[model samples]
Target: MKTLGQKIRERREELDLSLREFAKKLNCSPPFISDVEHGRRFPSEPMLEEMARLLKLDVAEIKRHDQRAPLDEIKRMTEQDPGYAFAFRTLVDKKLTPEQLLELVNRSKPSPKGGKK
Candidate 1:
């Protein structure tokens, strides 16, 4: 798996874009762009959006390369929120399919009178 910066750098290189040129498109300093491409910094949401547009790539592709929070942080969040913990535990325990998960999500939605929505 490539780092986010590596992905960004690779895309830029593929398009034959110089660092300065890419920075101009993103409205950021070249040094900042360099940092981002070297894994010393990450782009903000707006920057990521602009990068996706300029690179002609899906935003999801860029987002997919983003580093997730550490496991300890995830554990902390799960422990802090009882409802979230329960839902997550239930999901793990039941190993629900995508359709089943969708059903559970939709089940929480309010229906109009006569139980129709």
Candidate 2:
């Protein structure tokens, strides 16, 4: 499980892009990019998308290492329906294993795309 910084730095080096060059392409400062690479900070969603495109990596791959809570989204969901809040509380109280969580998600309704469950 490589950290986002490790993945980005490795891919950037593999593509022979210098820090300044990568930053220039991303329209961000080199220092900010350095901070992200050193794990001092995480890139925003839009920035992560751009990095994924440039590095030929999936956005989800980078996002898995984000370490930031999706607090805004969670708050919105909980406000929209109390069920979401209850579900979250239950999950925290039970301290469900990651594997259990994935299994639970897998048992949910199929996607709109009609993909297999």
Point to the candidate with the largest lDDT: 2
Please, what are the lDDT tens digits per residue for candidate 2 over residues 49-85? Answer: 9999998989988787676678999999999999999
Evaluate model 1: give its lDDT.
0.85
| lDDT, candidate 1, 1-117, per-residue tens | 688898899999999999999998778899999999888998888888899889889999988788754679768888898776787788889999867887877887667764545
RMSD to the native, candidate 1? 5.8
TM-score of each: 0.63, 0.74
The per-model lDDT (C-alpha) reads 0.85, 0.90
Q: After superposition, how far is residue 5 of candidate 1 from its true place, in Å?
A: 0.3
How many residue pairs clash in model 1?
0
Top TM-score prediction, candidate number: 2
